[model samples]
Target chain A: MQIRPLYDRVIVKRIEAQRTTASGIVIPDSAAEKPEQGEIVAVGSGRLLQDGTLRPLQLEVGDRVLFGKYAGQTVKVDGEELLVMREEDVMGVLEADAGTTRKAA
Target chain B: MQIRPLYDRVIVKRIEAQRTTASGIVIPDSAAEKPEQGEIVAVGSGRLLQDGTLRPLQLEVGDRVLFGKYAGQTVKVDGEELLVMREEDVMGVLEADAGTTRKAA
Candidate 1:
């Protein structure tokens, strides 16, 4: 049972936060806010425009993305929790191995 | 004090829901969910891509749009509540008049 999003939508798996803080103190699950980071799993083809052309999305699979705390809907797919949101919900994508320098696409 | 969102962001004013239901029952504000419909008040310049090119946004000012329940950040601007979100948070745009015909640009 594969789930595919419709036009411009994306499916993402949340990246769990590190259990310990920088100070090496364990942050309890109850006190921590939901993680706002995720990795793209699947994406829609594109939105169909008024002129009958598809406007391609900016996000791609495997991109590590940051989103707002309240962005997207949570759904249980195959017993795993996942988020489904539009490409615009993504604030930015983290670059690979660069420390910083995020790209908002 | 003008509020302009940076790159691919948008400012939206929520469209208030009708106070009365179809059965002429008046609904109280406490029981109503925040309206998901909005009108584009302002838009940001296109996002800067990795190749240093601007990818223009699909949303435009004056267009009516739909969004998810927790799409954007709410801010007070000139005593009015406004939502600031990226263009991707917009699900679709409602066409003007003629009954129905939404364009998802």
Candidate 2:
């Protein structure tokens, strides 16, 4: 089934962090924290205004974004674990040049 | 210290849910889930684009918004608990006529 978020909501696929540290020590899944990075799959049209106008979202599908560890609700869509959150829950989109080492705060 | 969110970030004050249910049952604090509603206290200028232009945020200070549970990072500002989230995290703004009973999904 296809899923479409209403309003300013977005569907994100979490990007798992690398299991190994720079020192090459591998971290087990049981000890690893959930990654705060994700790639946008779909975005809502925009926010519904009091005046009934729809405001477009700044993010586009395929943009990599960062969020708080606890942000968004985990949902299983088509057997895939995905996250659905409002645009505000997204901290910022990563530029292409931003390396993976950068952590979003 | 004064807090100013950069980019499309927003600072919100959570609006507590009503303790008493419609049946007059009082839910204790420990049993109460964190409310998904909030009032915007401050908003950032906008999101930064790759071209260096800033996109304005759709929300304004004092607007009541609804978000998913665990949508933002909680911070203590001036001894009060506040949430800082991206503008995209805000699902929708409540209209003055929208009653309090309407839960944001």
Candidate 3:
């Protein structure tokens, strides 16, 4: 199935919740919680402002992002899981290349 | 438990996944998947750009928004479920007052 989100919306493939922690602890999927991250698969052109012009997303396809557990609309595209959500739902592009990991304070 | 998200992040309470369709078809929570919508409860100052300036969010507290299914970090605050995610993780503020329900294209 083909999918496209309109106006600053994005389609994401959730990085399945981790099956293990940093210390080699095994966490079963059923026992594992949903993840807060994902890989960007598709993106909308950006948000359309009240003025009718588009303010495109700063992020590009393939950017790693962190989102809320219950953020986007659930859809099964081509039998693969996908999320259809707004660009605003995305908090920021994860700077994996930044070499510094940050946590919520 | 007290919760705070850092930099351009926001916390939301997922509007519980619907147990029924808009037309009254009951869908179980387990049979039902997670929800795509939520109520904004907390927010961060904003994203810090490369220039070291803050790019604050346009949204304020209490806005209804649409987010991805598996977007933010899951947490239970005061026994209520919450998602601690970045503001950028938010795609956009849901305009519940706008009177138009937009669907993904």
Q: Per-prediction interface RMSD?
A: 11.7, 12.2, 10.5
lDDT values of the candidates?
0.75, 0.76, 0.68
Q: Candidate 1: misplaced stretches above 4 Å?
A: A1-105, B21-25, B96-105
Query: For candidate 2, what is the DockQ-based docking class?
Result: incorrect
Clashes, model 1: 1
lDDT of 2 by residue, B1-105 (tens): 334455778878899876998999999857998888999877765675544456767787889999988787776534677788888889989897755665532
Give a tens-digit lDDT track for model 3, residues B1-105. Answer: 334344677778788765768899888777767778888776665575544345666555687888877787776544567777767667777663764666442
Better of 2 and 3 by TM-score: 2
Q: Which of the predicted structures, 1 or 2, would earn the higher DockQ when compared with the native?
A: 2
Superposed on the true interface residues, model 1 gives a C-alpha RMSD in angstroms of: 11.7
Model 1 scores a TM of 0.49
Evaluated on CA atoms against the true complex, candidate 3 attains a DockQ of 0.05
Fill in the DockQ of model 2.
0.04
Off by over 4 Å in 3: A21-26, A99-105, B1-105
Q: Per-residue lDDT for A13-54 in model 2, tens only?
A: 998866998999999866998877789999998777666777
Lowest-lDDT window of 10 residues in candidate 1 chain B? B96-105
Cα RMSD to native, each candidate?
12.1, 13.1, 13.7
